[model samples]
Target: MRNKNSRNNREVMKRILGCIRPYWFLVLLSLLLAVITVVLTLYIPILTGQAVDLIVGKGDVNFTGLLAVIRNIAVAIAGTAVAQWFMNHINNKITYHIVQDLRTRTFHHLQVLPLSYIDAHPAGDLISRVITDIEQFSDGLLMGFTQLFTGVITIVGTILFMLSINLWITLVVVCLSPLSFFIAGFISKKTFTMFKKQSETRGELTGLTDEMLGNLKVVQAFGHQEKAQEEFEEINSRLAEYSLKATFFSSITNPATRFMYAAIYAGVTIAGCFTVIGGGLTIGQLTSFLSYTNQYTKPFNEITGVITELQNSLASAARVFQLLDEPALLKDVPGAPALENVQGKVSLNQVYFSYLPEVRLIEDFNLDVCPGQRIAIVGPTGCGKTTVINLLMRFYDVTGGSISVDGCDIREVTRESLRTNYGMVLQETWLKSGTIRENIAYGSPDASEEEIIQAAREAHAHSFIMRMPDGYDTVIGEDGGSLSQGQKQLLCIARVMLNLPPMLILDEATSSIDTMTEIRIQKAFAKMMKGRTSFIVAHRLSTIRESDVILVMKDGHIIEQGTHESLLEKGGFYAELYNSQFAPAG
Candidate 1:
C-alpha cells in the first residue's frame, strides 16, 4: 500500500507541475532572479572577510581598501534585495494563477459530471477538495519551490566558495552535511503517513461541519442538537489528535537538523584554527570559511522544512487530482447528433437500471406516452418513481434496453440538446443568491421583465413577491433562505414556466404549498400542459386524478397502468393508494 501511495503521489506531482506549463516563462524568470539573489547574498560573506583582511592590525587599518570593500558590499546587498523582491512577486503571481485555473477547471468538470457521481458523494467533501484542499496545495507549491531552489543553490555555492580556500576543510564540511540529510530523511519518512492522515481527517471534519450547518433547521426540528454536537466533537477530537501527531514529528526535523549542523559548525571552527596555525589558511580565509559553513548547513535545515510542508501539500494534491481524474459523464457519445424540435413523445422500452451492481432499482420498466399526454406515476416511497425521472433525464443511463424520445434513442443525442427540451420542478427547490426576477428567469437568462412577471403570476408567486420591498427585484438569500418553503417552490415553478420546454417533470413539486395555492398552481400547470408532454410523480392522489394515464409501480416493476376511473374500478394498487389518501381516519 505504501509503495502504491508513493507511485500515486509521484503521478500527482507530475500533474501539479503541468499546471505551471503555461506560465513557464514567468517561472523561469523567477528562478533566474532567485539564483542571482543567492549569488549576490553569498558575495556578502566574502566581502566581510575582505574588509577584515584590509584592516591590517588592531589600530593599523588600511582605511582606503576597507572603504572600497565596504562600498562594493553595500551595492551587492542592495541589488540582492531588489532581485529577491522581484523573485517573490513573480512567484506569487504564478502560484495564484495556477490555482485559479485549477479551481475553474474543477468547477467546469463538476458541471459536466454525471449526477450519479454528485449524488453518491458528500457535498461538503467535494467543497473541501475544491476550495480548501486546492488552496493548501498552492501554498505548499509556492513555499516548496522557494525553499528548494534557493537552498540547493546556496548549499552548492557555499561549498564551492569554501573549496577555493581550503580543500581539507571543504571536504570535512561536505562529509558532515549529509548527517542532517540522513536524519531528516529518517524523520520525514515517519511524518509522511501522519501528515497524510491529518489532511484526510481535516477534510472529513470540513465535510461534517458543512453537513451540520447546512441542515441546522432539520437538526433543531427533531431536537438533535446533542447528538449532532457529539458527532462533531468526536470527529474534531480525532482531527486534533492526528494534527498533533503530525506536527510533533515535523517540528522535530528542524531542530534535529540544526543540532547536526551545530556539531558540524564546532568541528569546522576547530579545524579552521589548526589550519590557520599551520600557515595553510589565513585569518581572513578562516573567518570566511566558517561563515560559508553556516550558510551551507542552513540550507539543509530549510530543505527539511520544505520537505515537511510538501508532504502535507502532496496529500491535498492527491485529493484534487482524484476529483479531476473522475470519468466525465461518458462524453456525450462521440459526435452524437443534436436533438432538435422534440415533440415530447417518450418511450421506455424494457428499461433496466441499478444504482448498485447487486441491487436493481429499476428493471424491465416499460412506458409509452404520446405527445401532449399527461402521465402520472404513483408509488410508495423508494418504489422507483424518482428513478424513472432519473432515467428519462439521462442522469443515469439504463443498464439494459433503451429509452427514446420521438423514436430517437436518447443516447444518440447530445445531452445538452436532449436535456434542453425538458423543464423540471423538483420537491427540493433550489434558488441561487439573486434577485427574485433572476431566480425566476434562471432557465431563460434573457427573459424580459414582462415575461418574468407573467410566469410568476401564472405560478401564483407574483403577489407575494411584489409584497417584498424590492418586489421582483428583491435579492433572495442563498438557497432562498429568507423566503418561506412554499415561496421558494413557487419561484422554481416560475423558472420552469418561463422556459416553456416541450416536456415537463413535476416530482411532488407542490408538496410544500398550501391546498388553495396548489390548486391555483395545478390550474396553471393544466393550462401550460396544453401542448407539452408532462410527467407527474405525486404522493397526493388528488393532484393527478385527471392525468390521461396513471402508472402504478412496485419493486421496480410497472404493476398496472390506466386512467384514474379505470384504475379505481379495477380496485388494484393504484385504487388502494388513491382511496387511502382520502380515506376516513379510524
Candidate 2:
C-alpha cells in the first residue's frame, strides 16, 4: 500500500512553477546573499591556513598585518552569518505568499464548484486536501525551496574552494557525493509511499470526525457513543501507525547521510595527513581542507531532507491540481441572461433524466403550470418528487428536454437569476450558527430590521422568538441546535418569506414538524402562498386538498392530474393514494 512513483514529467512541474514566479526577485536576492555567505565562509578557512603559514614562517606573526587580517576575517564571517539570516527571512516571506495564493485559489474554485461535486465527494477527504494537504505542500515548498538553492550553492562553492586549494583532497570528498545521492534517492523513494499513506489516513480520520459531528444526535440516541469512539480510535490508531512508518523511513536518511558524510570526512582527513607528512601540501592547507571537507556534507544532508519533502509536496500538488482540473459538467450556458422578475409559469417539455447515463430515471415527463397557481405533486417514494425540485433548481442537467420559466429556457438564463426568483424550503431545515434574526433574514440579507420581524411574524416564528432571552437576537447554535426542529423550519420559512420570491417550493417542508407546529406553519404557509405560485410535495395527501391542481406521480410519470375533488371523483392513482395514506378527517 504505497503510492506509485509519479513519472509526472517536466510539463506538470512547469505548470506549478508559476508559484515561483512572484518570488523570483526574492529568490535572486537570497541567492546573491547566499553567494556572499559562501564566499566569506570559504575565505575563513583560507585565512586560517594563511595565519598558520604566517606563524610557521618569519616567527614574529607580522603583528600589525596579522591583527588586521584577524579582524577582517572575523567581520567577514559575522557578515556571512547575518546574510544567511536575511536570506532565511526573505525565503519565509516568499513561501508564505505562495501558500496564500494556492489556498486562496482553492477556496475560490470551491465556490464555483457545482453542488454535485460536493455530494459526490466525502466531506473528510475534501476538507483534508484544503487543510492538511495544503499544509504539507507548504512545508515541502519551504524545505524543498530553501535546501535546493542553498544546498547546491554551498556545496558547489565549498568544492570549488577545496579543489583550488588541493585537487587530491577535493577529489576524495567529491567521490563520496554520489553515495549520498544514491542513498537519498533510494530513501526518498521508499519514504514517499509512507507519506502518501499518512495523507490518505488523515483524510479518512477527518471524514469520520465530520460524519460523527453531523450525526451526533443519531449516534447518541442509538447509544453508539462508545462504538463511534472505538471506530474513531481504530482509524486514529491506523493513522498513528502509518505516521510512525513514514517517520521511520524518513529517519533513515539522517543516519544514512551522516554515515556518508563521515566516510568523506575520514577519507579527506587521511589524505590530509599524507600531504602533511610528505610535504606535498602544507599543514595549514591540510587543516583548511579538513574544515572544507566537513562543510561539504552538511548541504548534502540538507539536500536529502529537502528531496524527501519535495517528493511528498509534489504528490500533494498533484492532488490539488486534480481537483482544480475537474470540469464543471453542469454550468450556465454561454450568453445566458439573468432574469429580473420571473412570472411563476413553469413548463417541462419531453424531459428525460438520470444520475446514471444508461439507467434513465424519468422519461418523457411533461408538465405546465400557469402563473400564481398553487400546485401539489404527490407521488410514491422514488417516483421523482425530489427530482422535480432538483431539475427545477438545475442541480443536474436533463439528458433530453428543456425546462423553461416564463418562456425563457432555464438553460438560456443565468443560474443566479433563476434561483434568485425562487424561495425553496426543504424537508430538512438547516440553519447556520447565528442569531434568530440573522437566521430568519438569511434569504434577504439586506432586508430592513422591520422587514425581518414582519417576515418572522408571517411565518409564526416571531411569537416564540420574542420569548427567547435575547428575543430576535437570540443565538441559534450550530445547525439550529438551540431551537426545536419545528422552530428551525419556521425560521427557514421566515427566511424564505423575507425574500418574497414570486415562486415558492415547499418539498415536504412540513413532513418532520409535529402536528401542532405543522398546523400553525400551514396557516402561515397559506398566507405566504397567497397571490404567489407554490409547488408543494406532501406525503400526506389531505394536506394538499385545496391545491389548485394536483399531479400524482408513479414510476417517474404523471399518472394522474386534476383538482383534488375531481381526482377523487375519477378514482385514479391520486384518489387511491389519498385514500390509502389519508382518509381526510374521518
lDDT of 1 by residue, 178-234 (tens): 788888888877777887777778778888888989899999999999998998899
The true-versus-predicted C-alpha distance at residue 316 of model 2, in Å, is 2.2
- How much does candidate 1 score in TM-score? 0.98
TM-score of each: 0.98, 0.93
lDDT of 1: 0.89
Runs of candidate 2 with Cα error greater than 4 angstroms are: 1-4, 9-12, 54-63, 223-234, 329-331, 583-586
Query: Model 1: how far is 95 from its true place, Å?
Result: 1.1
**Which regions in candidate 1 have their CA more than 4 angstroms from the true location?**
none
* Lowest-sum lDDT 10-residue window in model 1: 190-199
Q: Evaluated with lDDT, which candidate comes out highest?
A: 1
lDDT of each: 0.89, 0.84
Q: Where is model 2 poorest over a 10-residue stretch in terms of lDDT? A: 1-10
